[model samples]
Target chain A: MSSHAGSVQAGQIQRHKLVDRLYHWVMAVCILTLLATSLLPIIGWKFAWLAIHWVTGLVLTVAVLFHIVRALFFQKPMSMVVDGQDLQNLGSGGRPGKYNLAQKLYHLAIAVLILSGIASGLVMLRKIDTPWWRRDPYWFSDSSWGVIYSAHDFVAMSLVTMIIIHVYFALRPDEWHLTRSMFRGWITPKEYKDHFDPKRWNAEEEA
Target chain B: MIVKDIMAPFELYQPAQLKDAFSLLDSFGKDAWKMAGGYDSLDWFKDRIVRPQAVIDLTGIAEMKGIKETPDGVEIGALTTLSEIENNPIIKAKYRLLADAVSHVASPQIRNHGTIGGNASQNARCLYFRYGLPCYRAGGNTCFADTPEGINREHALFGADRCVAVTSSDGAPALTALDAKFVLQSSSGQRVIGAEEFFVGPNVDILHLTAAKPEEILTTIRLPSAWAGKNFYFEKVADRNVWDFPLVNVAAAISVQNGAIRESRIVVGGVSAVPHRLTQVEGIIQGKALEEGTATLAGQSSTRDARPLNYNGFKIPLMASLVTRAVRNATA
Candidate 1:
């Protein structure tokens, strides 16, 4: 598209890059699998959920760690933050930079949930008989195990509601442009202009 | 918010020269639309608001894309992007009000892509008109925005268009205050119209915000030397600090010497079909020492002629304070 323009530069702006999209989809799939494997057995549809859930949770943890590295180094990390402009723009039609306030809140919530689930699950590894670790359920006392299990269970349950909201927004017709942008890495110019403020987002050089 | 998935294929008329542009426009007439920077015309096309048979791309015409100091004053080509006008040292040093307003235009990308001509001649800001309402601006008789249930907090306080949509161009008020003139051209010859007269009332019923004929193109904007090197104040009070259209914006170029006001040009946008100049408010403060209360009084007097709708009464005070603030700034 850039090559086609003789004098006028084309206006299709690049939003998300390849790494961001890949990390997002990988984390999405892993989280869904983990949620299903953990929650499906409560309704009696049981089929070795522990192994699948633990493996998916570990994969999600790794993916999230990779995403953190990428977000910090490769992509624009500042877009995920809440700054002076966000607070100053509390009311009015002012658009947040790259990510809006709601999106930032969602990211913060998911980060907390994921970190808590992983930290607590790592402690509960002593209760499981894995190849690397022996089944030393006695290593931590019942009270300790109860604390770890409680934290893990609470976050795991909270994610069910969180993911529902995420999925609902991702599929909503009004939000289809945003979801499509995640895959294509670009939004229609109209959507980008109408929703995002280029002054804050700084998507283009002169804009 | 494209109502269509793909743009309707049209003949892309890339006119590299003025002669070719005129010929192509003359040939296509109403079916051809002049595209400057493609930010405004493309938006209309992408939104399916207009389906042109041919789009006369003006970016390739190199002669029509620069700012130069003419004998009288500065002459900016119509295709000059807002970024160019906003950053050009000449415009900043001379037309500072225009530069200030240009900087706050719809986001940065739009500033880069939207041209001065496109910004000035773009469509009205009526939400109903854009939503396919059969309003007068949409070439229909009904005024949906004036209805009780219609959202009209930003509708015009003047030019009672059955449409009530005000001119949304941010640069217009500054130009109107500066006494700029638009140089329009067709195949036959070129004509000049004052910035104040370039914008017409809603009685025209054209599906546009300006008085440019369908065949004619705005080629250049010529500013008078009167307002050059003058003290000016530009203020835009949008819902956001940036990236939003103005709820009400004011531009004032007041010549004050020895703490006494001599000449003042106060023009406001987002309040009317055209950038309405506040002659009454200008008169209130003209030749008067702008003491602490004088600017406030001028500001308070700004709402004298405002005929606001049900939901837009806030604009009266908003315009007043903004006018007052602009006067204060100019005085300061």
Candidate 2:
């Protein structure tokens, strides 16, 4: 957040700053575009979807790599990982933290999808023409290429499903404030109380 | 920490005295809820289960916040922090079973905020009810955990209605074993109910755990003197040490003379909506001279009648192990 992004008098906590918000929206657009381009051609719409799909996938891969670096050093990253306590809290109705169990689980899903997509997508790139190189269709054996393609296809399907579920929860009326916070950078006192346990989140407690 | 409200907006009342509190309760009627430490009420408010017109904050009544001794036994205020109960010298020395049970509740932070009365009065920890999923406890006719579709491992082994989910309070079994009585007060009058009878069992009310009326308030809990000097044991089986409700919790207090057992009171929590008292096991041990191997025999004797769901069949042996451990430790 910038210096003026949050103030003590507002009784609000800065959840996401301008940089994080920008990265989030850009990644969302790229993923949505990638999905549309990949799926539309299969459903029989005829356009140059391959070029667009691979480009967007590459962009997403780079963005994720940047995200990993930023999170490791500059961001609050530990909250995104599911710990031993979280697995038990699933059945026990434990209290919420800064990022909830659902958020941590979603992060796990995204990490799996994006990392798999990137690795397999990189392997498949040898089959296609790129700006840097010409297409070498026989770069790998038939069986190895088949395995890479299968993995890429499976991740694409899972990503679609995960995005659908994510959209459903992110748009819920009570959770609207969560989406708003991502856009606006700060949350109301009531929103903070609704979503995060202050003692655990260790955010602005006075709110 | 209370969840931010999702229900209809409510008026908050902080009445200074018991008289003012009762009048607030009477006025609000079914639209009123009495909140002490608010560990339970906050979840209710967030889930939109109890949309109150006015939430009567009972912590304001200074009278309902302490532990004291009487000629008969000890009285614990409804608003008394579980940390206070767990660490209080009087409770640690006299009511070891209750203290032990309180110490295992969730974590230190939760114990600091959760009250003894609030722990008892809350609803069952059914994921269906908590998430407003399709189930009878969620006000629908369907019993999710009763069917093969829902996960039943955490459900009840005894006293199960259509909803098989169990109560999650660790404080309950110890209170029941110690023969505690919950004191209830309303504008009409005051009444005391035994701890076992305080919670509404399966056949009685499937949705709620307590039988208290909407306007009634749980004022204090009274522990009798008879069990104060007895040997006590508390054992809980949970996945983690902190911030997890017990998979099975056992509390037992036995009177042993020399090597022979004279009387026994055993209660188990988290396996059912109501704390299940193992009277048959208690009966079996009353006459026997307890030894190292007696606990193993008693453990096998307990599962003679347990009816577990498909996934919760493992709880039968788990319950036995916990009971055996509790009984063995009680004698030791």
User: Across residues A121-174, which tens digit of lDDT does each residue of candidate 1 receive?
Assistant: 877665454669533444565566667777888998999999999999999998
| TM-score for chain B of each model, two decimals | 0.96, 0.95
Worst 10 residues of 2 chain B by lDDT: B139-148
Q: lDDT per residue, candidate 1, B17-86, as tens digits? A: 9889999988887798888877656656776878999988988888889999988999999989999999
Writing each residue's lDDT as its tens digit, candidate 2 over A78-186 gives: 8787777777767887767777788888988888887998899887776554779644545666567668878988988999999999899889987887787777767
Report the error of model 2 at residue B185, Å: 0.9
lDDT of 2 by residue, B231-319 (tens): 89998888898888888999998888888888888888888888888898888888787776778877888777777877889899999
TM-score of each: 0.60, 0.60
**Candidate 2 residue spans exceeding 4 A from truth:** A1-207, B1-8
Give the Å shift of residue A147 in candidate 1. 77
